[model samples]
Target: MSAKIAVKGLKKGFITDQGLLQVVNGISFDVADGEFVAFVGPSGCGKTTLMNIIAGFDPPDEGTVKVDGASRSGPSAKGILISQHGSVFPWLTVQQNLMFGLNGHAPSNKEQLADHYADLVGLKGFEMSYPHELSGGMLKRAELARALVVKPEILYMDEPFSALDALLSLRMRKEFLRILAEERHTVVLITHDVEEAIHLADRIFVLSARPAHIKATFAVPFEHPRRLSSPEAQGLKESILRELGV
Candidate 1:
C-alpha cells in the first residue's frame, strides 16, 4: 500500500535564549495506510516536534509533510492529536464531552453516535461521570472515545498513556490495542518508552538527540497482544535502547 503519511527531509527549530534550538533535522519516513508507527528517543530529541509537523500542528522549517499524497498546510479535521495530557474538559460530563464535537448533527444522531463510541472505548456506564471523577485510565479512554467519535483518518498520539501509573499504563496499552484493532485506526505515536514502542508499534523509528533524525528503523515482526516478557520482545527493547544510546 502507498503511504498514508509521508515526510521528507523534515526539519524544525525554535528560538530560545541560547539562539536557534534545532529539534528535528533531516528526518524522513512513511507510515503505510492503517499502520501503527512509533517514534522512540531520549527526551528533547524532537520526537513530539516531528509528530506535530506530521499532524499539521506545526509547519516544518524545511522539507514536507504529506497526508494521502497532499502536502499538509495546517491541521485537518481528518486527523486528531491526543496529547500526553489529554484534552478532556474538567466540567463536562462524559456524555456531554462526547457530544462536544458533534455540533450541527441532529440530537438523536449525536446521542446514538456518542453512546456507540462510549461503549467502544469501554466507557458505557460512566457517561455521567466528570473527568475528575474518573480514574487515570478511564480519562484516557474517554479522550480516545472523543477522538474516535469524529472518525479521524489518523490518530496522532503523543504518549497517550504516559501519565498513568505502570499498572494502569499496561492496562491502557491493552485497551488501546483492542479498540484500535476493532476500528482499524491508523496511528503515529510519539513515546520515550522503548518497551511501549516495542509492544505497540508495527514499526519503530529511533531518533537522535537534539537535532533529531532517524537513526534506525525496526519493523516489529510480532503480532499484537504482544508478549512483552518474551525473549524476542526484550531483545528488541534492548536494541532500541542501544540505538537511543541509553
Candidate 2:
C-alpha cells in the first residue's frame, strides 16, 4: 500500500555560540499517498534537518512523525531517504550499489532486482560501471534506482540534483518525472530551486528562515509535463517568492 506521512509539531535544536538554535520550530504537514511535495526554504532554515527526522536518521526534539497511519521511531521500511550528495560506495559498481541494501535477500532475487532497476533508471548496460567511472547524472540515477528497488512507499529526497552538471540535471529531472508517471510513489523533496520545485511537485510548502514555521503551502495543480515557461508556472514562482519574503 502507498504510504502517507503525517508530521506534527516537529522541532529540532542544537547548541551553538548563539545559544540553542531551534532550526525547525514546531513545523507540521501531511504528505498524501503518492503525492510529490516540495519543501522550500532559505539556507539554515532546517529543511534538511526536518527531512532527516522524517527519514528517521535523527529524532525530533518534539512532535510525531507518523507513516502509513502508524507512529514511527526510526527509519521505516515504508520509506527511503536519498540525500543531496551521492551516497553510492566508490568501491561498488552501479549494479553492486543497487545491491547494497538487499543484503539479506537471495542472490537470484537480488540480481533480478538489480536488473529490473537498471532498466528502470536506463542503466541496463552500465551495471558493471563504477561510480567514479560514471558521469554525475549517471551516479545519481544509480542511487535513484537503488532507492526505488527497495519499493519504498515513501521517498524522501534532499536536494538530490543540486550539484549535477546543468544538462545532466535536466535529464535527471525528466527521469524523475518519468518514474513518477510509471508508478505513484509518495515523495517529499527538499529543494531551494523554485523552478525545479514548480516542475516536479504537486504541492509546495514554504518554510520561514529560522525557527522554521510553515509560511505557506501552495497546491501546484498543473498537469504533468508542464512547460517551465508557461504563464501558470511564472505565477507560481512569483507567489512562492512573495511567500518567502524574497
Candidate 3:
C-alpha cells in the first residue's frame, strides 16, 4: 500500500492571552491508501490540530504535509472532514444536504446520486426531513451520506461518534464499518475513545499529553466483525490504554 497522506516533523502553535501555546510537536506519520488509521490522545493533546493541518484546513508552523506526493496548500475536494457534531445544514432537507456538493453534475444526476447515498445510509424515507427533525443517530447518518455522496478519496473523521450514547455509538461504528467495506475510502480518525479506535482502525497511534507527539503505535490485526471480547482484541486494547496512561 502506498502512502496517500504523509506528515513530517509537524509543529504547530497558537498565540494565547498568556503567551505562545504550542500544540502539535514534531509529529509525523503516513496513512496508506484505503487504510483506516486512528489517533488516540489525551484531551487538549492536539490530535485535532494535527488532523486539521493534514486536511489542509490549517498550515503547520514547521514541517510539511503532502497528499499523493504533492504538498497540500488548502482544502481539496479529494478529502472531506466530518466532526462529532455533524455538518448537515439545519435548514436544508437530507436530500438537499447530500446534493450540496454535486454542483458539477447535472440536476438529475445529482438527485439520483443523493438519493442513492441517502438510501445507503438508511435515510431513505427521511430525505425530505431537516436536521432539526432528526435524532442524533439520524443526523450522523445524514452527515455520513452527505460526505460519501461526493466520493472523496479520503475521509477525515474527528470523534465522529462522540456525541451519541454508548449503544448508539456502537451501532454507528458497526454501520460505519459496513459502509467503509463498500466505499473503501482511505480514513483517518481522531478519538479519545480507545475502544472505538480499536474497533475501527487498522492501525492506532497514541499521542502524549499537550504539545503532543506520537508516543506509541499499535497494529490491530483482527478481521472484520471483530469481537472486542476476544482475548486478542482485549490485549491490544489494554496495551493502548497503558500507552495512554489510562
Candidate 4:
C-alpha cells in the first residue's frame, strides 16, 4: 500500500516559562492510504502536538511531513482536522453549518448536499436545530456531517470522542467505524483511550511519556465491530496497557 502520509524525524517544542520544552522528539511514522491508525499515549505527551504538526496547524522544528508524496508547509486543502471537542458553528443551524464550506456551489446544490450528509449522519429532521439543542453524540454526528460535506481526502481526528460519556463514546466509535468503512478516507486519530484505540484502529502506535516517540506499534487483527470481551481483543488491550505502564 502506498503511504498517504509520511513523517520522518519530526521534532517540535515550545517556549515555556521554565525554558524550551521539547515535546515531540524525533517522531516518525507512515499512514497508508485508506488506513485507520491511532496514536495512544499518556496525557500531555505531545500526541496532540504531533497531530497538529502533521495536519499543518504547527510547523515542525525538524524533519518533514508529506501527504500524497508532497511535502506540506501549511494546512492542505484536501485535509480537515476535527477537534477533540466537535467543531461546529453554535450560531448556525445544522444545515447551515454543513453548507458553510460549500460556498462556491449553487445554493440549491449546497442544500441538496447538506441534506444528503444530514441523512447520512442521522440528523435529517434536525436541520434547523442549533448546537445547544443537541446531545453530545448528536453534536459529534453533526460535526462529522460538516466535515464529510467538504469531501476531504484525509481526516485528522484529535480525540474526537473524548468529550462523550463512556457508553456514548463506545456507541459513537462503532458508528464512526461504519461511516469510515463506507467513506474510506485515510484517518489519523490521536487518542489516549486504550479501548477506543483497540476497537477502531487497524494499527495502534504507542508513544512514550513526554518527548513522545513511537514506543511500539500493534496491529489489530480482529474484524470491525470488534469484540472487546473476546479473549483476543482483551489480550491486545493488555499488551497495550503494559506498553503504557498504566
Candidate 5:
C-alpha cells in the first residue's frame, strides 16, 4: 500500500530552564492509507510530539511530514484530532457538538449529518444532552462522533481511552473497533497501553525514552475482535512488553 502519511528525519526540541530539551530525534515512519497504527512508548517519550507534528498542531524543528504527498504546515480539514485532554464543549449538547464542524454545509445538511454520526456512535438519544450529563465513555463517543461527522480522511487519537476506568476502557475499545469496521479512515493512535495497542492497531511502533526514536515495530497478524489471551496473542504481547522493557 502507498503511504497516506510520511515522515523523515523528524526532530523536535524545546527551550527549557536547563537548556535545550530534545524530545524527538531523527524519527521517521509512514502510515499506509486506511491503516490503524499505534505508537507505544514510555512516559515522556515523544509519541504525542510526533503525533502533533503529523496533525499539524505543531511544527518539527527539522524533517518533514507529508500527507497525500503534500507537506503539512498547518491543520487541515481532512484531518481531525481527538486529544487526550478531551475536545467536548461543555456548553454544547451532543447534537450541537457534532454540528460544530459542519459550518461549510447547509443548515439542513449539517443537522442531518450530526444526527447520523451521533447515532453511529451510540448517542442517538443523547442528542440534547450536554457534556456534563454524559459519562466518561459517552463523552468519548461524543468526541468520536464530532470528529467523524466532519468526514476527516485521517483520525488522530492521543490516549483517547486513558481516562476511562479499566472496564469502561475495554468496552469503549470494542465499540471503537465496531465503528472503525463500519467507517474506514486512516487512524494514528498514541497510547502507553501495550494490550490496547495490540487490540486496536494494524501495526505497532515502539519508541525509545526521551529524545525518542523508533525502537521496534510489530505487525498485529490477528483479525478484528482479537483474542488477547490466546497463545499467539499472548506471545506477541510478551514480545511487545519486552521491547518496552516491562
Candidate 6:
C-alpha cells in the first residue's frame, strides 16, 4: 500500500465575470499501488476538477500532484486518463480508432494489439465497424481497450459507465472491474454513483458539497462482481448516503 499517487493541497480556479473563482480547495489524498479508489460527491463538488489535475489535463493554480514520486505536468507513461465523454474519433473504424492509440508503441504488431483489446472488451468481431455505427456502451468499451492496450501503471476513469443503460452499465461495470482486477492496474475513479463506487472500489473517498475536500474514506470488503444485495455492499451504500446527507 505504498503511495503510487499523491495529491497535496490541490487548488484550481477559473476566471469569471465575478473574477477568479476557486473550484478544488486544497484537497489532499494518497492512492496506493494496484488499488481501485473512487471519488464520490454531488456535481460541482470538484471531483472531476481534481481528477483532471491528477490526470495532467488540468493544472492546479496551487498545490502538487505526483505519480510514483515524480511531479506530473502532462499525461505520462505512468498513467492514462479516460475522459468523461467520447475519446473515440468518429471518422475512424473501431479497429482504426483502437489502433490509433497503440501505434508505434508496438510497431507492425498493431493488429495483434487491436485484437487483444477487441477480445478484452468483447468487441472482437466489430473491429471494422465505425464509431457512429456502434452504441454508446460499445464506444466506452472501445475507449477502455484503447487506454488498457498501453498497459498503464495507473488508470484514471471519470465515470466511464455512466452513459449506458442500467443493464448494460451493470454488465460493463462487472467486465471492466474484472479486467482491472485481473490486470492489477491501480485506478482512481471519479463518480457520483455511491453503489458503483462501493461495488468496484477497494477504497472510496467521499467529498464535501463543493470547494471539495475529503469528507470521509471507506473501505469496501466485498469481492469482484459484488452483489448489490450483499449486506456489506448495501450497508456501505447506506452509510455513505447517511454521511452525505443524501
RMSD for each of the candidates: 1.3, 1.8, 1.0, 1.2, 1.1, 1.5
lDDT of 6 at 109: 84
Query: Whole-model Cα lDDT per candidate?
Result: 0.89, 0.88, 0.92, 0.92, 0.92, 0.86
Candidates 2 and 4, the one with greater lDDT: 4
Query: Mind sharing the TM-score for model 4?
Result: 0.97
Cα lDDT tens digits, model 5, 93-201, are 9999999988779898988999999898889999999999998889999998998988889999999999999898898899889988988999999999999999999
A best-first ranking of the candidates according to their TM-score comes to 3, 5, 4, 1, 6, 2
Best by TM-score: 3
lDDT of 2 by residue, 120-174 (tens): 9899899998988987778889889989988888889999998887678778889
Name the runs in model 4 displaced over 4 angstroms. Answer: none
**What lDDT score goes with residue 44 in model 1?**
77
Report the lDDT tens digits of candidate 1 across residue range 160-246: 988988898888788888888788878999999998898889999998988998999999999877999999999898898888887
Q: Tell me the lDDT of candidate 5.
A: 0.92
lDDT of 4 by residue, 1-246 (tens): 558999999999999999999999998899998888999999999988999999999999999999989999999988999987678999999999999998689999999999999998888899999999999889999998898899999999999889889998987888788888888898899999999999998999999999999999999999877889999999999999999997
Off by over 4 Å in 2: 1-3, 103-105
Poorest stretch of ten by lDDT in candidate 4: 171-180
TM-score per model over all chains: 0.96, 0.94, 0.98, 0.97, 0.97, 0.95
lDDT by residue (tens digit), candidate 6, 1-246: 559998899988888899977778878889988888999999877878888899998889999998888888887878888988868888998888778866466565887888888889999898999888888888999989988887889999998888888888888888987787679899999998898898789999888887788889899888766788988778889999887888
Off by over 4 Å in 6: 103-108
